[model samples]
Target: MTPQDSAGRGLFITFEGIDGSGKSTQARLLAEALRGLGRDVVLTREPGGSPGAEEIRALVLEGDPDRWSAETEILLFTAARRDHLERTIAPALDRGQVVICDRFADSTRMYQGLSRGDLRGLVDQLHDLMIARDPDLTVLIDMDPDTGLGRALSRNGHEERFEEFGPDLQRKMRAGFLALAREFPARFRVVDGNRAIELVAAEVREIVLDALT
Candidate 1:
């Protein structure tokens, strides 16, 4: 393990990507690698890390697509995120344990912001006020939206509210993420996610190591 400074006790890392960009897979592999190196790691995902949030996740992902408005979706996501951060992420980092989250604030900014349009600044303001800490680093796994949507459809056997928006909306979602990364270049590292899993894992491992060292 790399030596830490007096204040650099724990590292908070977030994985962001459009659906089916393999963010979850990469996050899991990264966490496994960190654990193998004897580091304490907390692995979790957004919109459902805590028990309450997980229940919300099921509702958000399984409900009828037409039943939810863009604003409604955004609200639910933020609500889930607030609980997740409070119940799961904060405590792990406070203990000097690395937290590898599957999706974090970026998901809301991208999905809610782009698909839903401007929402009177609700998403950004709420995030600023609620989330206590920003991630130390955010790794964005990027892939073609069409390809990603196809992968998601094949894996899930159907699309949900947000997922059913089709390729165009998904493309815009990717753009939203790129915009956010650009808005915060120093903290974000974009990874080409169009490659095989092994290749992607190698790149992700290097990024994590670089951040830790």
Candidate 2:
């Protein structure tokens, strides 16, 4: 019972976690593994995956974390999501391709919703209104907040705005993510991400392949 069924609609898998939890690397590794099996896979990321959304990614991910209010960030992310769905994710799924995304609405639910304020309700409202898609599976790579922060900052990436929020928010985000997993157990799978990359990836692959069956 692989993701593709009789109707051939395909699967949508998203990775979510605090920064440096290795979700991004796992996402890529999963995509490569599946492709090696000859599955039609489309690997993409949000706040990206489409041209318009990539432009918005720069706006949201760069600069100061305080640059945009939570409300404004929600709007920006929602707009990018709508464009991405229209231009990238939807079409790929329509063709019976597994779409593996680095992040999706859950990130918005965590970052803008819980961070800086209790705006989860607002985030859900926008999600239900403009972007109605949910991933078939969400692999949340659980990690130690301090270690995750150190790994994130070590990258010295331009998208350092969120990492610049420092370890406190990372701790909050990690707990919040675990809470989210509990809230959505059917689609959520938590993988310990503090191990060697290969071990983490092995568990991730097993979880996903199990879901496919």
Best by TM-score: 2
Weakest lDDT window of 10 consecutive positions for candidate 2: 1-10
Candidate 1 structure, TM-score to reference? 0.92
Error of 2 at 144 (Å): 0.2
On residues 1-213, what C-alpha lDDT tens digit does candidate 2 reach at each position? 654442255789999999999998999999998877668899999889999999999999999889999999999999999999999999999988889999899999999999879999999999999999999999999999999999999998899999999899999999999999999999999999989999999999899877666
lDDT of each: 0.84, 0.92
Candidate 1 Cα deviation (angstroms), residue 57: 0.8
Clashes of each: 0, 0
Worst 10 residues of 1 by lDDT: 1-10
Model 1 C-alpha lDDT per residue in residues 45-148, reported as the tens digit of each score? 98899998998888787857766776888778888888898899888888988999998878887777667777637778777877756899999999999999
Residue 102 shift from truth in candidate 1, angstroms? 0.9
